[model samples]
Target: MAKRNRKKNQAGFVFPAPLAVVLVVLAGFSLVYVCLKAKTEALGQEIKALESRSVQLRQDVVREQCEWASRLSPASMEQALKAHGLVMTWPGREQIVRMRADGTIDSSVIPEVRPPARYARVDRVVMND
Candidate 1:
């Protein structure tokens, strides 16, 4: 009777320690996995935010380029030139007045021109003596 009881007790207790060890190892692994999962999720969110910002920056660049293109169009340039009294005459099509040896255009057909004087006005103050 004692031998049978001893054998039964040994067999039943054989798996407890190994099962407890396995449970502990599994718990530790689960904790590590949860931490890693959380970190990976955070990194994914950051990547998504950066991608959205990059797209927005690209769109802004395209919009600015379009605006600049419109502003620098040939018609706009011609209008600006007209406002300044400048004409885009093709090469060899302009009326070239020949310059004389005195560094002046030939006065036979062209009149001599002079620049206007520039002046600034100052207000005078009257003081009582």
Candidate 2:
């Protein structure tokens, strides 16, 4: 770009009209490009930070699950039962009650709960062929 000589009183050179306008436009574009580049870099940094946090959280969850599983092993459960002095036994025949296929419960079992009137027969009815 050619710079024209200014008047003797002026300190700086003057640019032609067309050249000045072009220079102004180029400067505006440069400013916009710099702002956009900075924004893009900021967003990239934020994404990297979030990804690192997500990975750390996942690792923490896996570690916690492993610890939980180790604490609930069969041997640990047996030791806990012995520590509490609790006896382990199977249910007796009298403690178990058999259910009948009919709507009425087994007579051997007391306090039979009869089904509601609507539930007496659940067979579906066909309509319109």
Cα lDDT of model 2 by residue, 14-47, tens digit: 6788999999999999999999999999999999
- What is the C-alpha local distance difference test score of each model? 0.80, 0.79
Report the lDDT tens digits of candidate 1 across residue range 54-127. Answer: 99999999999998998799998899899987777653413346798989877575534446423445689888
- Candidate 1 segments exceeding 4 Å error: 1-15, 79-87, 92-129
TM-score of 1: 0.50
Please give the distance, in angstroms, between residue 113's alpha carbon in candidate 1 and its true position after superposition. 20
RMSD of each: 8.8, 17.4
What does the lDDT read for residue 74 in candidate 2? Answer: 81
Task: Estimate candidate 1's alpha-carbon lDDT, on a 0 to 1 scale.
Answer: 0.80
Regions more than 4 Å wrong, model 2: 1-14, 81-88, 92-129
